[model samples]
Target chain A: MKMLRNLLCSAALASLTATGAMADGHGWSLKKAAAPYAGTTVDVVFLLRPGYEAIEAMLPAFEEETGININIIKHPYENALGEQVRDFVAGGDLDIALIDLVWIGNFAENDWILPLADVQAKYPDAVDPKLDMDDFFPLVLNAFGGWNDTVYGLPFDNYSGLMFYNRCMLEEAGFDGPPATWQELKDVYGPALTKNGKYAFALQSKRNETQSADSFARVLWPFGGSFLDANFKSNLNSAESQAGLKFRQDLMQYMPDGIVAFDHAETVNGFSQGDIAIITEWSAFYSSVVSPDTSKVADCVEIAPEPMGPAGRKPALGGFSLAVASQADEAEQAAAYLFIQWATSKANAREYLERGGVPARQSVYEGDDLEAFKFVPALVESWQDGVPEFRPRFAEWPEITEIVQEWGTKMMLGDVTTEEGATEIGTRMESVLEEAGYYSGEKPLAQ
Target chain B: MRGQVSRKTIFAFVGPAVIGLAAVGIAPLIYAVWTSLHFYNLTKLKKVKFIGFENYSTVLTDEVFWQAMGRTFFLLVTALPLQIILGMSIALVLHQPGLTLIKTLCRLSLVLPMATTYAVVGLLGQVMFNQKFGVMNQLLGGADINWIGDPENAFAMIVFWDVWQWTPFVALVLLAGLTMVPGEVEEAARLETKSKWTVLRYVQMPFLLPGLVAVLILRTADTLKLFDMVFTLTRGGPGSSTEFISLMIQRVGFRGFDQGLASAQAIILLIITIILAQIYIRVFYKEV
Candidate 1:
């Protein structure tokens, strides 16, 4: 009976797609204009995530309607960028790729991924008119998609860093809510919450981009510090940055002993295992935190907007965008663009959200389904207030990230003073940028 | 005459190996040297151009590269001698002419560490050497020691982990070498010498020298290129204290996307390894 129903649905979708009319039954459909490219196969490579798994589950429906075979390739998060870069370098046939926002400048400047404007210009009907570009959060749309006035990708997955706290632990510590500011967190909540083998906090400080950009920037921005000054000079050694580093060092006393080596896995697992009281983590971890199999504090965990920093509240923004590959042939590019459009459209956004995907659509956040998840309000608030450029999003970010990770980690471990670390990072970053032709005074900071 | 090979026979025996070596080893080395002379970056493919030893000059002057070289040398110097002592001691104990069951059990246990992959050992070290909840601290009556959090302790833990994983292989090799030492020669030396130490010093030490040299050469080469253990264990932390030369090359190549610099660093590492191997051959394997 299910097979017959599916066949009927597929046949109806095919007819609707062929007739150049919108399919209204399921409230979502591939553009009828995409019929010309029906038989094209688009190969997409992305990092494995729960949201991607949801998209994989919806592949059959998409395939049946569009008559396009979707070949999904997943790589581990750590190696995904390298794999994509290598693929682009070799001109391998990849139709679509999930690109990290930090990689936008690199991919765009190098012309690795097709500019969406060019795709739209070449194929007039590539993007559906009904696909409301205004529905996505402006911050996310600009951060993930727009690069130097050109849209390179569509924002697919969105993340905002939030403080996930153990409600039970906080209650036991005589607090009704999570800390509102960094000072309260350090002076009051951290000490009170730490007890009986449970640490007050877990941080993602492992010596990588996570430590330098995601975890460290969460504090740096709140302390009113930026990676670069207004003139594109390294400002890491500023007083605000030093104070933030010192605060992080002091907070270590209430954390796990080897907190310096903790990464996303350790931080998330520590919280899940009830060994950590609070963690500032990406909103995408909502599914894992609420899952019964993975989390011990599923019932007691609560999400809150990032604690106030000295400068103000600035949440860490981390996520990826789905972009069409320039190396792909014309038909594949159109097919990929259609897929990106439909996947991020309002009609499909709610469904994607229900299936553990975090959509960037603002309408979805304002919908009735907002009441379904406990973290939605806080997550939405973070999205509205977060600073996407807390870490520089440029082609040379990967190199700069290494310098930050090296010196920032040293400062965190007390092996180097904050001033020394900042100086070293600034000097090394200047050299790296100079070698890349940034300081020549002729070229802009990014090509 | 029977053992002497014709040209075709020689080709039959060595042709596949020669092809394999050219494809896997020689090709990559040549390509690395070629790349080292250019300003090639994977991210900036369009900007690739030949720059003539600029990358080599950059590497030679880079302080991080020199620090990494110093750390690699420190690790090699510290771990090799300790590994040799531990291996020889175990080999001597296992070669004793009694307690067959104990010998069998010891031999089986010796293979255990050698059997496990170094990557797995590195990961296990992370859990076991964790400062807070690790089994090592738990076993030490909950004493607080920052094994991977402190720069010194992290470096020590890396050395200790390498020693633990490789000492067994060294022991097994030395045990095989010890067996090849004839019993009659040792007994004759024992009869002629006034002390057991004198017999071992004269008879057994000479027999073990060639195998010792081989083990030293292999371990030195392996340790020089050590990456997986460091990558999985501490990621060259805290603050690059445990960063090995290979890790630096990887960071420069993959993360920094500077293929030219990485290739230059790799070529320098290769030259250093060759020089060390020659020294070992000259000093220990004079017969060769």
Candidate 2:
């Protein structure tokens, strides 16, 4: 038995040698002698979004076609991108990666991603021609994937902040429809809707990326404020912006106090359980909110545009992007690009949307299948009007989020004055920018 | 003595395990230390340049780091005493007679929170404390109170969560100590006509000293590193009131993308933990 096993191993080794030689001879370059990697299984790190199972299930067909085995490693959205960045810097072996839109600037700045231009040039036909860069809603893709005029990543799943409310609750509160403006939301609907055991709103106030994206950023643009001036100095502390922050804090008085502890799930649960009247949440959560099994308020929930601030209505854009690893081998890189192309193709996006995924493309929003889905029209309109704050995209976003969460939550709790919070955020943000070389000691970015 | 084994045999037994230890432990420790000394810029594409004590100084001086530290300590203060008191009360209850079924049920109930995943626990806590239909508010007729939105309520919820999950762990330790008390000693105290309070103060507590030490040591370390409960609960919210050290480290390391600074902050936390452990050990082992 030992002799037979040895003989089989020798035969397998011979085949492996032959394949390695063949790979080197057939245009494969490597620092060491090349192996074809045809049968070698590699893990493709995927962030497990709502509709990702179908994309993962489709991978077997690609594996069969390519003659290479694929393994899927799923991670939460934030951790996956954070791990990808660490892996790239440490030269760790990661074949494929999923990243968020706001992470593009930092990824691009550090050259952590492989530029797809080379892959596109090589596989024009393999790449989806229908991607039609022009077809994507300008703000969605522009905020996430575009950096220094280069398209760094492909949009995977994209969504904008939209106001989701209990239509029944609104009607019960003596309103026939959702509030149209910030004043109406605060003065009229918020007070009227707030009653014995229910809150008027369930907006996220807990400091994190979600708070920055869905709540704070969405309110800022509507109030005619931006994170930075044209020169990239911190501009979130303006009086108009403070008004927006204060308005959100005041609104919390009528909402659930546990909002300080609430992230996306708590807020969604609050609304879906018919505990709160309204929630300004991501479009991606639409299907779940309206699904009967998951939500008691499903039929009662209706989508509406984000409320207008003093200046105008501006909704925050939230989305994901696909970027290939710089360190992935030739075959892996080719596989990644192919996977991205297929995963984000027009057909795939439509399929994803039909399965309740939010698509980045404008055309997908108009699809008959999507229109049939509940709240699709409102979601589409919100995407069209999305005011993408772009997360400031500095490497310091995590720290920036901390600053925002600390002060934002404090303001909501009435622990800090808006001016105090805003001034502190602006000061800290300036120092971060200065350290990042966006500003000099002699003159701050704004100065 | 059989201690003098063959040198070759000794090496044969220890070599692979030592190599494994170094591979898993020493390598990362060294790497973390090395990384902690450098700028470790993520956006700049530049190799990590050694910045000596710069990152450490920055972390020490950074206002946010101090704020997170304060918040972390605040959570500890809110959680620790409540956890100890509740745990002792439960432990005392479990010591009663003819309560076997009740004791078993109580044990099972107390263990449930620890058994639950933090995300679920956090979400459940939020739901219970929800200003509207939350069971906690509804039970208290606090239908209008927002338990997580306001700073005070947010802090209260975090404390409630910390106590809920951990009080049982403390109770279990104290209960174990309660069971170790000698029947004869208790009987002697009873025969001496000792007051209930005196018996508890002198006999019961002194015997539970080791157990109390064990609970305090574990709780202190656990409370110091409290992350998921807060992260899942308040996410260090209605601003920085709920922010703690672990979340702060994550914010700095992953979001800020400044490994050196994060590492520096982490080292400070490590030092604090070590100092606290030392203090605990000294007090525990002190000759009274």
Candidate 3:
């Protein structure tokens, strides 16, 4: 019986080695490598997004191949961060978490998420050498997938802001294509598109993080402005930023009457309902615009890189990353890492894209078959020029974001002038930074 | 021997409840008070230190905090009275000694709004109050009211939503009080006055005062802690015009990640609530 058991062990080792050799030759495969962790179940918490849904649809294939069960816990975008924070606090059974770009600093600083470098080192065979991590867009990989010079996650659902427009409306307005500049948007398209009681523009100006960080920063960066200066000081009150704010105020005249209360949902819904002609929204919203069930102008919608400012065209770069939790056990962590690797692999990029996900891999964008996806060209253009640091991804960003939203909303509501709003935001942000030990030299500024 | 036995039995019966209150309530309260005295931020947890009264001073001096407090009080003053009046009117109609089936149906219909979740109600409000395509604008001849875009209108919408959901609760409470009002006493008053209005004013109102006070207390407490609806509908938006104290506390604690400041503000809110409750008890419970 002992001789038979030894022989069985040798056979198992031989099979694993053969599987590893095959993986080396044929890019990557999870089935053989994950045999030891076959029955392990990884609980992953994520926000409900088109890309995630696509991944979820393909999860069954992964389960069949690796014999690992995946329990997906999805939450709305608004509540996902809070749920993650609570889960971390409670030490919940989370093997992996979909972390927002802004949360990378907090998670990394607090040691809530495991460093991917360490995972790669410990489980060397778990990483496929031929996977080619360099194939991912350097900007996206560095911004969303790493923190403080340490890799923590893999990019999933990377987004860049695009100017989504109604082609029919533009044609009716006697325009050949979408406006190329903010000036044209305000001066030419605004009046031309405002026909038959329909508005020309819509923005997500609701007093929340989406408005303050994502939407507002998109405009700010294009106008040669940013949230913080090189020395990490508030630069919102600068002339460039003031001009952007003023430009936004000017554009509001052509927007819906109650634009102040509009959020991402409202803005997208407005565009879909044919109530608005142009919207500078995330490229990820392309799916919604093209879906017949959700949009009235599905056939008439076209996407372009966001309109330019005097400085240049710098659209917003925003997305989340799938990261393994530090609290998860070794076996679960390995399984989670394997899932992320497979989900983001070049082999799966095309299928992931076809299933309503935006692939972070550069090869997918450069594919010769890209003409099949209408928005791929424009998305590539936007991604190539997008500004990742438009919103500072620091631990205190959430608090600073509240200040921006509060003041920015007040300014939009006409309760405060652009200058007053800028001053208040700067002052409050400075104080918050100081309290967080950024200015007092106690802690270094977030990278 | 009998007294000792009875005391032991009472302790045995109530021990679990007492322990539960201490564990869930008193322990958290004590912890919150201790946290309030420290400089505790979750993101920067390692930097926590006792900073006595600093967070309180900061909260007191904050303009936004004051504004939130003012808005909460405004909601309480406006919605509580509106709820009481509307609830009392419905209760009076329901208490009319006939049309039992109609009364039952009306009561059920009135309670429907309260039965629904506040988050769902807020979501419905978002759609119904949408300025461009909402049912409200459609009903109002498509005038484009901007219900949630303007500060004043947003505040009014919040009050309206609260009244819609809670007026039935107030009505039910008052109806129970009205049922408790002896029919003989009401008849005697009617006989003396020979006027329904006079009877209501002199007898029915006096009998219902305690109930009204109870409704006010409950409504006041709830309105003060209004968070879910605001979080869903307006999110204290239109430039924080409708931001209430509880929403402010949540923003500080969760969004701001400053547990110390949140705890301080929470303690202040608790103190204010206790004082107001005590005042209500002293004033209304005197007659009872």
Candidate 4:
């Protein structure tokens, strides 16, 4: 146990050194700051996403250095945002919350989070002034954390959706490549898979964030349709949207019958169990799917571009952000900002990505070490151009989520016409938007 | 002075209990009532302002709410009678005294289901009734029956789940009544050459009145608030075909974050349950 402990420590030290070197080369490193907020124990809430398993492994080091005991409250992926929102609303003591990026609008608008500008002002070297708005993926950084032209949160672990396919299966089916267009997808590859058999394509259809992120909105974007029109009116009932929905329903023929109820675990298990030949999901699962221990087809796996639609190949951005709660005590508030800066720093992000985290930094994406990411190229392309139909980030998102989930499930189940479902959804979405004051005296989108 | 002392002692003993109930239960009940009279959205939980009777009006008008209530009523009406009849039959069979091993096995089997957790029972029920990969489908040679997916079939499956889990409880209740039926009365009726049906009708059932009432009252309250099995199995899906009122309340309050509407629905449901309880007590204990 002693030798094992030393080896583990050495490994951690080596990774830390490598990250520090990377940061130094990039001119993003700094000397340690004066111990302000010393001896303060702050409660930091972390949503239990996969990459954070490494951070959790390394938390004792942070605690040892800072003398601040971090209390990690890991919520299930499904209820994490809801729980954070509830905590903030109830005036519960949450020093920091790792909120989903899409949920930032609601958090900021409701004044549930403290502005981080002042905190960022104090720690110049710890959080470089030039680096504050530079070297990061501008779209992701600005969209999620910046509200009303002010930064209120920081991007943590970020992901762009991508496609995975069984290379062996494709090769055996008289193809040496992946489909590049929607028509080609339907024509060249549609008939190669079976439904009842274990070796089928799988897609998420569960009624949650994954559904909204990966399945529904991803499909909608490629069809030149969106959940909301330019004027923020619901446009779900439009012809373009219906066409996209119909495409997904048609694709269900080659997928598992249990797709309607499948979540991330089910989809991952299906692929690992050799039950699926293809998967299109969040890029975070790429490493696990290609890891030999976790997947049987690991050796035979290959990352492919997202299948093209009428509009283009656009995938949704799926990730989380860091925020300080408005209700935190002053000391706790300072600690929370420090933690966010430390957590998202260039050095930390590199170490994080090496352990399979997808960083929000453009430098990380462009780095040499990321070549092993396998899908990094596609992930970057998608992230840069993706139309993030972020779950209508408003106070009424839960209600709007239900509208999408219930109708999305119906569309998947073939229980309703896409046009009909979209019409109903549009009506409900309009009402929610109107009630939330997002919709003005504009004509509703075409049904 | 004696009366005063007695009153003082009673108040002293009961004070804690009264305070405990008020603090734990009655306060929440009162708060729920107060909230029910307003528009309590969780997002605006802190800023919740009074808007009397609006939530109630909304509850009465929501299509999904009515659907949930309808499904709940159907479950209560269908499951209650069937549960009692089946429970009484099993109880009667167990009351017989001949084969010790068989009797013990039967009693054990009846108790085993009740001992299992409701969530586990719901899951087991789903597995049994699963369309693609279920034992029921396999037994029927994979005939593609949508047991838990179709509206009519899902309702029947939920009712079946309820009966399977709780019929044993009903049987246990009736078994107590069966044990208490006087042997002399039964023997006397036998000696008089009364038919088996006649003896059962005249002696057994009348003696089991209180037990039967107990089963009804317990099952009525339980079936009215059925949430777990239905929630786990169907999730009140296929367009809310099997939604129960409890599930609706949870959705409105927790999922929808519309606390006032949920509270209003709860208040209405409470009044109904109370009225039903009083009526059942009056009908069952008239002689007593």
Q: Supply fnat for every model shown.
A: 0.85, 0.85, 0.80, 0.11
Name the candidate, 3 or 4, with the larger TM-score value. Answer: 3
Scored against the true structure, residue B228 in model 3 reaches a CA lDDT of 92
**Interface DockQ of candidate 4:** 0.36
lDDT of all predictions:
0.82, 0.71, 0.83, 0.73
Cα shift from native, residue B92, model 3 (Å): 1.9
TM-scores for all candidates: the values are 0.91, 0.81, 0.94, 0.87
**Which prediction has the highest DockQ against the true structure?**
3
How well is each residue in B1-288 modelled by candidate 3, as lDDT tens digits? 666678778888999899999999999999999999999987777789999999999989999999899889988989888888899899989998989999999988987998999899889999999887789889988787989888999999999999999999989988987888788988777778878788777777777888877887878788888899988899888789888999889988988778899999999998988898889988876462
Which scores greater on TM-score, model 2 or model 4?
4
lDDT of 3 by residue, A1-447 (tens): 332243334333333443554565465457766877889999987667788888888889999999888998888887777777777777888888787788888888888898776776566667655456667776777668777666678888888888899999889878989999998999999998887779899978888877786557866888998888877888888989888988888989998876778878888988999989999888778888889999999999988888999989988788888888988898999899889888988889999998888989989887688765777887788767876677888888878888998898888888999899889999999998898888888888764
Highest lDDT, which number? 3
lDDT of 4 at B104: 85
RMSD of 3: 6.6
DockQ of each: 0.73, 0.52, 0.76, 0.36
lDDT at residue A44 of model 2 (Cα atoms): 68
Worst 10-residue lDDT window for candidate 4 chain A reads A2-11
For candidate 2, give the lDDT of residue B26: 85
Mark the regions of model 3 whose C-alpha exceeds 4 Å error after superposition. Answer: A1-28, B1-6
